[model samples]
Structure formats: C-alpha cells, structure tokens
Target chain A: MPGDAWSRWRAFAFFAVLLVAIAVLFAGASALYRVPPAAVVHDVHLRVEGPGWTIEYRADTTPNSTAYAILAEAADRLGFVLDARRYVAPLDSVLVESINGTRNGEDGLWWLYWVDGAYGDVGADRKALHDGSDVLWAFREYPPREASP
Target chain B: MNVRSFSLRPHKRGKVPPWKLALLLIAAGVLGRLVLWEMPNVEPVMAVALIAGMLLGGYYVILVPVAVMVGTDVLTYALGWSGAYSPVQILGLGAFVYSGFVLAAAIGQAYRPRLLFRTRTIAVMARISIPATILFDLWTAFGDWLAISRHPPMNWSLGQVLEMQVPFTLVHLASSLIFVPIFGTLFLYLHTHGWPMAGPSPSGTDDSGPE
Candidate 1:
C-alpha cells in the first residue's frame, strides 16, 4: 500500500512554503530596518596621543557619525586596542578605558577625548562628527584648571 | 504466560530488513553532528532523534541522540576540539542535552500513530521542537552555570545567567524550528518508504503502520 504516495509530496511542498515564509520574514525585517547609507568621505584629522606615543591619521567620516566609529575604523587600520564598554542607562555609549596599551586609572591618569579643541561631554560613541573636525584623544590628568570647550 | 510480544523487537522483526537503513541513518546523523559542530545551537541531532523515536521506537529515542553526541564528541576530541570541558562536565551536559532528545523521541512515539507528511504533522513537529530546544538549552545552560559558577571569576546570579543566555537559546529555538521540519519530514518520508521504523510497539496488535 503506497498509502497515497501523492500525500508524501506534501513534505517537500511544505518545506518550500516554509523556506519562502522565512525568506519573506527576513525580507520584511530588513525592509523595516533603517539601514545606514554608505559613508561619504570627509577628511577628519584624528590624533590619538599619550605621554609616550602619538598616532595621527586622516579619516573620511560620514555625516552624523560617531567619534567612536571613526576611531574604531582608525584603530583597526592602525592595529591598536580601543577597549570600551557601554553600561546600562545613563552610560549607554562606549566609555574608553584604554588605547594602545595605555590604560586609564594608572595613578589617576585617564583617556580624555577632545573634539575640535572642546571637551566632549558625551561619550566618544555618542559624539557627532562633522566634516573637517579635529578629534584628539589624549591620556592626561582630569580636572584641568581652564574650561575646555 | 501471556508474554504479549511485539513483532518489531530489536532482534526480531526482520520484515522490512531495516539494518542497512538504520545504520546509514545513524552514521549520517553522527556525521552531520560532527560537520556542524562549530555552528552554535544548530544541529540535526534532535530532529534525527525525533525521527528515530517515531520510526524506530521509544527505546531508540533515548539511544540515538546519545550515540550521535558521544560518537561525534569522541571524534571531535580526537581532532583536538574536545569541547574543552572536563569529563564530569561533559557527562553532565550530555545527560541534560540528551534529555531534550529523549523528550523529542517521546513526542514522536506519542504521535507515531498519525505521524505523516501533512500540515498537522508539520505543525505538531514545530510545536514539539520549540519546547525540546528550550529544554535542551536550559539543561545545558544549567550545566554551564554549574561549571562556571564554581570558578572564582563568575559570581553571577541564576537570573543573570539566564538573561545572558536568552540570545543563545533564542537562536537554538530558531535552529530547531528550521531543522525539525526539514529532517523530520525527510525521515518520515523515508520511513514510509520502508526505511526501518523502530518504536515502542503500538498497543492492541501493532498498528504502527505499513511494513
């Protein structure tokens, strides 16, 4: 008894439908997502300097990109460690702990990021980028006497 | 002594002559597990075990996944991957993970009477696979937490452990959802075509299915 051999083809057909459903679901998800466009090249001066070493590079940052994104791109090309983490609320961006083997809290020394000669209030991961902006990351003491914009 | 015996005994029941098919399926399952070992939460062991249970019997539902895992784990160890776990931890994880396969097999046995390549069967398989996958992941994650929490570096609460593991289990769920239907249907079709079905003998005179 073939037991209705025609019924068995239902498996393949069912799998086909399943695959199509999955494809459609994924396609729908991707359509709903806001995919960022390709970055437009804007020459931004990036300087990551410490007491012992200074690494300078020029990067093409996209409009409204984060400083951390630019630094991450630079770090990958430059072969340096950019150890950062984003904690829970009130700290939802990358907090730089170390760069290029230089760590924060070594005798109270820390990595402070300055963009366009102004102290960035937000974390590096949140700082908006602009064309021709000079980004500086320095390992220095905090609580400077003069207010840095 | 009304020792009501089943015609489909492991040693008996040479009706369809399924040894070759069974061996091939077991070997294929082991090979699949080995080749796909690197993929997290994605493997055919559960689906294979379910098929084994549904077709072979409840006895094999327990045996198939264990055999697949142990066989592949041994080969994996020989190839220097060994899962990097201690013997005790391996044993513990295997027990929990195997339980999921057992549950799947049990479901197969329970549903064997009407297990066919139809819409209802597919829906049941999907439902069963989700819980089976969750059970396997939870059991394995418990094993992981047990192994990790003992180490000095880990001071995580159980809630935190589960929280951290939500993504992995979710992936496992998706994997099960995908693989269960694919393999289950394939095996079901094969079993229908006389590919050695084994399982607990259907009561009241072996209504298991066609030979």
Candidate 2:
C-alpha cells in the first residue's frame, strides 16, 4: 500500500472529472428529446396574448432555458408574429441569455440554455397543446407543480 | 564522481513547490476550454467551472491558454468540426485564453487562500472572487480586440468583431460571477471532506513578492 494515497486521489480525481464530463454529455443528450429541433422545457404554462386569438395552456411539464425560443416556438404553431430583434432574439427567436430554471422551485437549472423566463424543468419542451388557449410560458421563481401542505 | 550533491531529479528537495501543482491545475483548465471551443456554443457555466477548478486547485495561470489550444485542437479533430482553423484563429484563441488565465492567476496569487467561507476575518475570500471574475471579463474583451483588429489580420473588421463578441462577453461575465464563488465553495467543501487534491499547493507561493 505504498501508493495507497495516490491510488485514492486518482480515484477521487477520476470520478470528479468523470462527473463533470458526464454532466456535459447529459446536457447534449437531453437535447435529443427536445421537440425535434431541440430546446429545454420539462414543464410550463403557456399564455398567448392577442385581441381575439388567445391560446392558454397550463403545460404541466418542464420549460426551456430561453423564454423567447419558447415564445417563438409557441408562436410558430399559433401563427403569432415574433419580433426577435426588438426583444434581442434571433430569427429563431432564441433567447441569448442563459436562464437558471431552478428558480421555478425545481432543480432544472441549465447553467447554459435558452429562455426569457426560468422553468422548474425542461420537459415542457415537447408539450402539445390545443387551440385558442393562452400559452402562458410561465417560468416563475417557484415550482408550479409542488404541493404545499 | 563527487561524493557530495547527490541530486538526480528536477528539484533538489523531497517536496516540490506546491505552486507547481496549482500551475498544472490551471493548465488543465485551459486545455478544457480549448476542447469546448468548437462545440458550436460552449456553455459559459462549464467554462466557469473549469477555470474555477483551476483556481481552487491552485493551478498556474499560463496553463489555461496553453492547455486550451491543445484540448480544443484535439477535440476538433476528434469531433470533425468543419472549416480549418488558420494561424490567425490559433493566435486569437491563445490571446483570449491568456486573458482568462491572467485575471484568474492575478486574483488567486494575491489571495493565497487557506480556506473559503466567511468568518469575520475571512471577508476577503468573497470579495476577491468579484474582482477575479471582473478582471477576467476585461482581459478577454481586450484580447478579442487585439487578436482581430491589430495582431494577426482577421476576416472580421474591428467593429464587426466587437459587436459579434459583445453578447458572449456579457455571458462570460455572468457565468464568471456565478462560477468563481461556486467553485470556491466546492473547493472548500472538498477540502473539508478530505479530498487529497483539495489540499494546499506544495509551492512556496511567495505571497509577499511581486507577480
């Protein structure tokens, strides 16, 4: 056991590095399940604002890191006009900023991702919805799904 | 053969300067950054984590940029990222890498941290992180300017490069703010839990001398 300490440190270092690398991989992999094109949204509430056309959805799923992307994505299906430049979104309407989804009361904080508002999860990325409901795309500082006793 | 002076290794003593270990850590972090360069959009948080690890591990500063080149170069080949990187690109990457490390090292060396966390006497621990991260932002911005505008001629005009990188710079700053203290806390936590790599460096560190 002369090198016992080295062996232990090696194990610790290897695992520590492995964890970071794996986390990165998972970040990449998780995007695979994104709504075809890819984005984060484990859950969320969607609300569309307009005069006559209103699409509201309480999508009990995760939300992506970029709120504008969600807005754009939702707009794509709902036929709403997206002015990205005004809101600093690209043509894809992707949010340039990284949002901490954890503030939504869940631990879905993507240190790097897209969103205008935060989400409790990224499962909201694929939430299918009905017509005329206001897609609120709500990403608050508290989780929407948690039960308070 | 002479009877005296039986030193065969690099160092004449039994233990190496702890600073060397720290230098190695920072070098490793730089390498990590390089690896992340071609991934379309490298996560700022990951970059922050890598730099923070280097700092907390007490790694050397120069290692950051050097390792970044090697790491990213290897990853590029492995990942088959299209578009060959010219000498200008390489130089640009190196300059940016240096900007990151110089700031991290300056802050680290100045603060020879023994423990993280705030007691009454340990207020400097938290304060140093802010400056360290801000300095990183400033250096990186300058590096971009120098690399594209003057040094090696780049395809991007001075204004173009500045505008293009403005967003990323903000992201970098934000991530740094989030990262520096986080890694500091992690380093402290690991040290408290008996992680061997968590120990102070073997270097003299010379907290008193000029950097």
Give DockQ for candidates 1 onward, in order: 0.06, 0.02
Cα-based lDDT for every prediction: 0.62, 0.40
Cα shift from native, residue A9, model 1 (Å): 11
Candidate 1 lDDT, B115-193, residue by residue in tens? 4446556656666666666777677777667765424334446676676566556555656667677776565555444
Which lDDT tens digits does candidate 2 get at residues B115-205? 3222211223434544565566556656656653333213335565455454444444334434444444444343333345556654222
Candidate 2 lDDT tens digits, A46-81: 564332344553444433323444555555656655
Worst 10 residues of 1 chain B by lDDT: B1-10
Candidate 2 docking classification: incorrect
Kindly report which residue stretches of model 2 are placed more than 4 angstroms away from their true locations once superposed: A1-149, B1-59, B82-84, B112-127, B149-165, B191-193, B196-211
